[model samples]
Target: MTLDFSVVTGAWQSLLLGTVGTLFLAFSGMALAMIIGVLGVVILRMQLRLPSLLVNAFIEIVRNTPFLVQIFFLFFALPLAGIRLNPTLTAILALGVNGGAYAIEIIRGGVESVPKGQTEAGLALGLHKHEVFRLIVLKPALRAIYPSLSSQFILLTLTTAICTSISAYELTSVGQRIEAETFRSFEVYFTLTGIYLVISLVTMWLLAAIGRRAFSYPQR
Candidate 1:
């Protein structure tokens, strides 16, 4: 089909609105994931076997399963078990929890890569475990793995499209609505594809800047 300017204009409008929803879902999910990731990494660093095993198991399960299935389970199945959440809230919770699991593994790897000698030296200097981890381990781990963490966050942004399945009205869902209205599937979706690409690029750039600023000392 020939590219229709009218269709492009209308679809682009809808896509812009959908982008708001997309941003909300993606950023909120990442925020929650950050909390989960930090906690998981700290627990793993406790060197407790059971905590390590539990965290690892959660990571594997979330990473291995399809995100769509996880979303569906949280949205549909939980209500049957006496817990109910609105669609948007359920979508965010599901995505956040799943993304958090991946973040845990990534952050845990960074924590593990910290030098044993560094911990020993801190202890010899009479530092507490928490003090050592906060001052020495956390910064180094963040610096070493910031690139990986940023990539995961980017992936999480794209994963927001899964929210469409639950009618979350994110960017992809907006494109779907436009396609249905105008029957210009190609124009509708390709426009959205470009929008998503731009959003992802800008997000990664911002994340790189933040990582550099926050982790500057570690680089030195």
Candidate 2:
């Protein structure tokens, strides 16, 4: 049987909308993950007993558990506890929280790679500890770990498809709707596979450009 591209063409509008939603979710989730990563690293640096333990526990739980289980808990369990979240919000939150766990370790490793001498010098200049961390340590550390962090963020974007499990209505969800309506499973899903591949490829290209601009430095 010959493959028909028209089916995909017909549903392209919905698919495009879904793709936009996926991008939005991915960006928002990554932003939140970065925030969590930075804050988690700070908490670890503080060396406080209780807060450090809490952050570590959070990291362990998120990194060790299945992503689907985490999404399920946030989407379903929270509602029972008098905390209701819209599906898209739930998707973003779940992805952010899960990605943040891995991001913490990645960012922390980056921070650790920074020379202690540099941090000391920053402090010796009468800068506050936070200022030293921000200006002297964090930027260089992020540059070192940019590749790993970008890869993690891409993985988070791909995981957006799993949001369909909770009816969050992203790309996969839109494709499913098209398939159900058209009764053309092969055509619909094949198109979806291609779209996801394109999204991933384009995301990587954009990230590489951003890294070059933000992290690359000229030699003196």
Best by TM-score: 2
Give the per-residue lDDT digits (tens) of candidate 1, residues 17-57: 88888999888888899888999888786779999899888
Candidate No. with top lDDT: 2
Q: For model 1, what is the alpha-carbon lDDT of residue 88?
A: 75
Q: How many residue pairs clash in each candidate?
A: 0, 0
Each prediction's TM-score versus the true structure = 0.91, 0.97
Regions of candidate 2 where Cα sits further than 4 Å from its true position: none
Per-residue lDDT of model 2, residues 111-204, tens digit only: 9999999999998999999999999999999999999998998899899999999999789999988888878889998988999899999989
Model 2, position 65: C-alpha lDDT score: 96
